[model samples]
Target: MKAGRKVWSVLMLTLIIAVIAAGCGGGNGKNTGGNAQPGNSAGTTKTSTKDNKDVVIAVNANFITLDPHNASDTNSISGARTMYEGLLGFDENMGLSPALATEYKISDDGLTYTFTLREGVKFHDGTDFNSEAVAINIARIQDEKNNLRLRKSFAKVAKVETPDAKTVVFTLTEPYNAFLNKVAMAGMISPKALEEKGENIVKEPVGTGAFKFKEWVQGDRLVVVKNEEYWQVGVPKVDSVTFRPVPENGSRIAMLKTSEADFIYPMPTEQVSEVEGVEGIKINKVDSTIVRYVTLNTTKKPYDDLKVRQAINYAINKEAYIKVVKSGLGKKLDSTMSSKTQHYSQQNGYDFDLEKAKSLLAEAGYPNGFEAEIWGENDSETIKGMQFISQQLAQVGIKVEVKSMEGGTLSDMINSAKTPEEAKIQMWYVSWSPSSGDADGATRGLFSSEMWPPAGANTAYYKNENVDKWIAEANKSIDPKVAKDIYANIQKTIWEDAPWAFMGVDQIVSGSRDYLNGVKVYPDGSINIRQAEVK
Candidate 1:
């Protein structure tokens, strides 16, 4: 019998900135710990002093790395809160807004991008913003040793040239329609700083952001002081920003409840209502691109069979999983592409049916059900979610052994599971978010055959000639609509194959005291610290 297909795919087909001061010469500062009163509409924090008192911004995880060219994790991106600047930033409405580049123009050929630097911008270490700085920063990212995180996205750039002191031009080997959006990454560091710090600089960042880096004690806290000399006058109202790494969900919420911290970004969903009931605490919820999904090792056993893959997809009850695991903070996913994204197709991917799954299992010669290993990050929610799936799969005779480990370790296990001999785990839970709006932003790193196990991020070992062909054609297509349609097809095709059992999209929650102001959250989960203020 031909299976009823969802519109989504399931087949076996394939596919900134300037300088100001010279050194770390600033005033003495004190850390005032407690609940901060809300700031006025101007986005300021009342408890913060205009002078030397530092405002702290706490996080659950420490940064993975600070190199804009090399870092890929959210922690590293979030670390940009105080350390880097990009040419464009997301505004309160989640639209693109200017940052370092005052104005930019694309050549008639659409093969070159020219950016005119805004005057008076300076690096935290006091280097002037000019053509030389721009030239060097681009070159550093192009350098192979740096292993910049998003390097493949820039493979089309022919060269970076500075025509004048304030003007920089990026000549592309081929016209890249997504180039502008790709440059929205906050990891763009200053060339001067890179030359000075070499490989050691990420630990000590210097950028033209609202806050200035002061000190980072690994696994504990990263502190930043106010940038009084910041170009945008009256901006970054807070005296300073600090990121404290407290991994436990309960403790992180407790820190906010006890007034130990002024603001807690992304409060655990399970603890949301409890925190909201507390007076003086506000829970701001918004839709986001952060998604948690299960990636099957397509090249490995059990999963290699399309029916088995489909069986796995049909066996689990996603609605129940979301209700319990997400704790009311998720939206079901219909495709690998985020629902919040513009190009997403509304077609459904999979709907739960245990009987059909069992029949598919019997057809695949697993009538008795087979045993498989599943992996997820050690986080409380992730482990619990996987355990739930284990129980659901058991109803169909598939025994799932759940393994929990740190994210880095889990990543290693998935990466190493490429070859049949080396395959240890058959399935794993993974989450992803696009660095920017472009389709290339999500697919280039995760789907490309270029990224093999251990070396690149292709964890599923998923590859298809058709997907690759579509990607290549889309890359060459200059027309935005044409490219979008092709990528949309790619999303549909990927969904049909079931390489990943689409899971859920998460909501990014920010819990701030009434006093802290200027906190705007992006669907991508990035915070615009520059636009925030402390009263």
Candidate 2:
């Protein structure tokens, strides 16, 4: 066991040094120069005679589910976005805007929302989209038996009314300032399809987006065909799109280089230099709202002690993590939410201080530190991240065992525990993006006590009465200033409590062939292919 531990330690140290060296070396003088523009920017790649309408995007993971209302992971959400859209949608900057809904208004009391549906819209299955359709979709999500993943976002809805074919009214039991953002995330599905498919909607999806589901060969690829009869005339320039899950970083990059795939998300930051100046390829780097962190299971031993949690936070070097893990393509996270998140407030964060960490360990009654395990997904980047964390924590006498598991297995492991004491997790290295683009979206599902596992994403089992109260107040406050203040306080308190070893905010990076155009990646890392075209 000691020998194995030594070998693992050596490997982690070597990886950290190599990554730091790569970052220091900088982008290999090769200009990533091309007609490449931001995903949302106006431009097109060089035209090709070949059928450019058929595009393939190589993603790092398989789609968890196609049902937008139940999907949680980003990959699944991206798949849902290809063929499903909500009454509202997010722009490149993650700002809410109209999509299926032409216009909407919220009452002064914050209990009512009235929306005017777009006229003459039709679902992929040829069902007419009207106020009743919207009402049906909303009811399906709010239904308790269905067990939708985002039901909490609409739990307060008291009633749904369709006054006319074009107008829908929503009456809330109480104020919810984040309702608009939540609506933007609740992608609309065909009412008829829902009735026919029932729980099978996750596999066979039908929506009113620019694309329609074609085929899904689980673990292989999922395909979507263009909705030629789409509501938006002349849009959805692509004929078909195929999403392949290539979990290996090198393979995904190779697919981009060989034209086997037109695009690849989360282009390995370490390989940005290798792909730069490569023919028929371009890279898109944009500021992102995605934040990565190590969740310290506050209910576990050692971590149960406040001083130990704070010590772990101080032991990690955020700047070094950015340099090594992300190749300097990210910023050190100072708050729970990324700076790109709406109403985010920066707070003072723990700096790397080995002496301070040691002192805290002693105070926590662990002068020699304690042994613990760190969990993460079995992806290349996630493994590296876990190793780096293990190496960093070791510096402060904390012996960390790294366990990387498959995505689904990890989810089951984290959620299987019925109570905090039963949870086997000691720490988990993970990433989160508040795709809803609201402060409540960032806080409520993550920091709120009510969002514990089996219910929400608060896997850390972290709870604080003051923080919980603040989150509640912030979610209901219609005033922006009040919400901002409450969020600021939340950040400050959480940072001090150190429930997580806040890592860094990723700079969303994706690569594609010059022929692929009109594809935009939101700050939350979900790709928007509404206007995607292979030119």
Candidate 3:
């Protein structure tokens, strides 16, 4: 046993040294490490195509799906957000801003939200933007048979009606103050186009946004043409945009440096100096809504016991891990919901103490640590997090067998685990991306037991009557201030229970050429190319 521990310790030390060494050495210079310098105004990359009249931007990966209701992956949503129109949008600061809806009003009771559609708005197909299209889009998303994956917020939507040609009404079952924030995800689509294409409609999306869907080649590239009829009028200066999937850091950085690709979606940390020192390239960072954390399978042995879960969390040196993994770019998060959200409570922060963790394990009847599998996707961020957890947990007698799998396989492992017994895979690294900047938006779904099993994202199987009631009541709160208070309480309760060991808030980074200006870098990494023009 002593020899085993020594071997594991050496292995972990070696891995940590390797990661630090590789990070410092500039791995492939792809900007994956989140260390790139911000906005270099000098020099310019020659456009590969001889079209200086229009703008062309490049990203990693073609969109997986364009259908607003069905879009899942960030890549697809990023493309759709550009090609389609939402009632509202997040600006460069990621604050709520208007998009399709020119002006909107809430009822005195706050249950009804009425939106006045923008005039002269035309879909890519030239269909008039009106309330009918908005109504249909909402109806389709709420359809249970269709199994809309992104309908977490829309579950509260009772009905969507068009009272007038230009007026759209959203009637909620309860007064959900986050309704407008939710609308940011529910992009407006054309009713006529949906009728014409059916399921195939995703292939050709029509919206009033500044960009129009052109073509998508899976695993390779997706292209979009600028909307000449964009209702935003004078905006959308870019002529075209292309998203290419370059998983390899070396290749992505090579493309960015050589001017083959105008911009890379995420600038890795390892290549910070290369991109920053490069004359024409620029890097911008924003505090994203996404938070990385380890979701505990509370239903399974060891983790099923709150004491054990707390021990696992207490044993983690999150502050040190953040420095090592994020190179000090990431912020420590203790709440299940993001700190960027309005209702985040600082009272939930967890501190590291290996002695406390060991005592908790002993109190939970495991004087010596138990062995369990730590499952996570084979990504730089995920691996780094798991490594930290594995090393820290070892100090408290927990033996973690690290199993790295492909993203799809890891997701399947977590989703397919039906019961806590079947689902307990020691530690799993997961990301939480909230559409609405509210804790209720992300926490309610994660803490509620009803939303779990083979369906919802609550793979943790964490259930609490008090937490559930708080979430339910918060969902019904019509006033924003009231709802925020309720959610703050909910975060406190969850933190005390230690359902998850929150890691860090990732920095949303973007890279572009010197000529690209007015490129709005959203806090959640969603940017509006409407105002971006190539000089």
Q: Which regions in candidate 1 have their CA more than 4 angstroms from the true location?
A: 1-53, 92-94, 411-425, 453-455
Best by TM-score: 2
For 1-535, candidate 2 gives per-residue lDDT tens digits of 6677457646765666775454333221211111112221112323223465788888777777899998888889999999999999988898888899999998999999999999998999999989888888888888888877789999988999998999999999989899998999988889899889888888999999999999998768899998988988888888898888766666666566656778888797887876666556788999998999988888778788889988998888788788788988999998999988888888885887777899999988999988899998766678778878887988878999989886767778987887877888889899999989888888888888888886788887889999999987887898989989999999888888888888999999999888788887889989888888766
Per-residue lDDT of model 1, residues 1-535, tens digit only = 2354432112211000001011111111121222333222212223322233355555655566666666666666767645677777656544566888888999877888988887898888888867788677777777677666567767788988888887888899877777777776644566677787877777888888877888877766777777877888887777767777655555555556545666776676766765564556778888887777787878788888889988888887677667666766887877777777656765574687777899999999999899988887654456666777777788789998988775556656655555645866667786777757667766756676676565456667688788888888877778878998988888877878777777788888878765666766677776656655545
Clashing pairs in 2: none
Q: Which is superior by lDDT, 1 or 2?
A: 2
Candidate 3: lDDT over CA atoms? 0.71
lDDT of 1 at 73: 61
Instruction: Give the TM-score of each candidate.
Output: 0.86, 0.91, 0.86
The C-alpha lDDT values of all candidates are: 0.69, 0.83, 0.71
Could you tell which candidate, 1 or 3, scores higher by lDDT?
3
RMSD values, in order shown: 9.9, 6.4, 5.0
Residue-level lDDT for 326 in candidate 3: 68
The Cα error of candidate 1 at residue 67, in Å, is 1.4
Error (Å) of candidate 2 at residue 143 is: 2.1
- Per-residue lDDT tens digits for candidate 3, residues 92-120, read 65578888888899888878888988777
Q: Which regions of candidate 2 are displaced past 4 Å?
A: 1-15, 19-50
